[model samples]
Target: AQSVTQLDSQVPVFEEAPVELRCNYSSSVSVYLFWYVQYPNQGLQLLLKYLSGSTLVESINGFEAEFNKSQTSFHLRKPSVHISDTAEYFCAVKQSGGSYIPTFGRGTSLIVHP
Candidate 1:
């Protein structure tokens, strides 16, 4: 089974500052990585993903993450953040196969102070 670990439980950053949410995983086989964001009351939404083809992937919201197989890490980063970007971020991992189930991290709460 695969497992995900989020280094920090909370990150406090001011407006217009770059943020990086660290994520690491352990899996015996090849796996896919994903970053999901959860708003106040909404469900988890996909922020970015690293499937195959490319080692790096970016979201439409200006967040990017690179899949490093050797290091078994996929960290999410954003150049500049806004107060609206404050949310809970999660790192998920699942084996590459027909299974759609993913093991999720505890989640990192990003507080974008103004």
Candidate 2:
């Protein structure tokens, strides 16, 4: 079994500033980690994922997350931000085998101000 935890419900940041969205998870079995972003009312989009090798993963949009097995954490960070970066971020964990259902966090809303 696996569970996800989003440390912050909301994160406020200014445009061009760096930001981090914290996520932690627990599972008895090996799992895959993922980060998803939702823009306003739109659907969730796959941002990045850690499937096998290399604990570090990045998205095309400049967001990156490191999977820490010791701490059971996958924290998302962006060196710089834009107003368009505003969205709700979700952290997820899925059992490595068998089923594909993933446990998602409550979501952390990132509000970028000008």
lDDT of 2 by residue, 24-94 (tens): 99999999999999997899999999998999999999999999999999999999999999999999999
TM-score of each: 0.97, 0.97
- Residue-wise lDDT of candidate 1 within 1-114, one digit each (tens)? 999999999999999999999999999988989999999999999998888988889999999998998899999999999999999999999999777699999999999999
lDDT of 2: 0.96
> lDDT of model 2 at residue 88?
96
Kindly report which residue stretches of model 1 are placed more than 4 angstroms away from their true locations once superposed. none
Report the alpha-carbon TM-score of model 2 versus the true structure: 0.97
Off by over 4 Å in 2: none
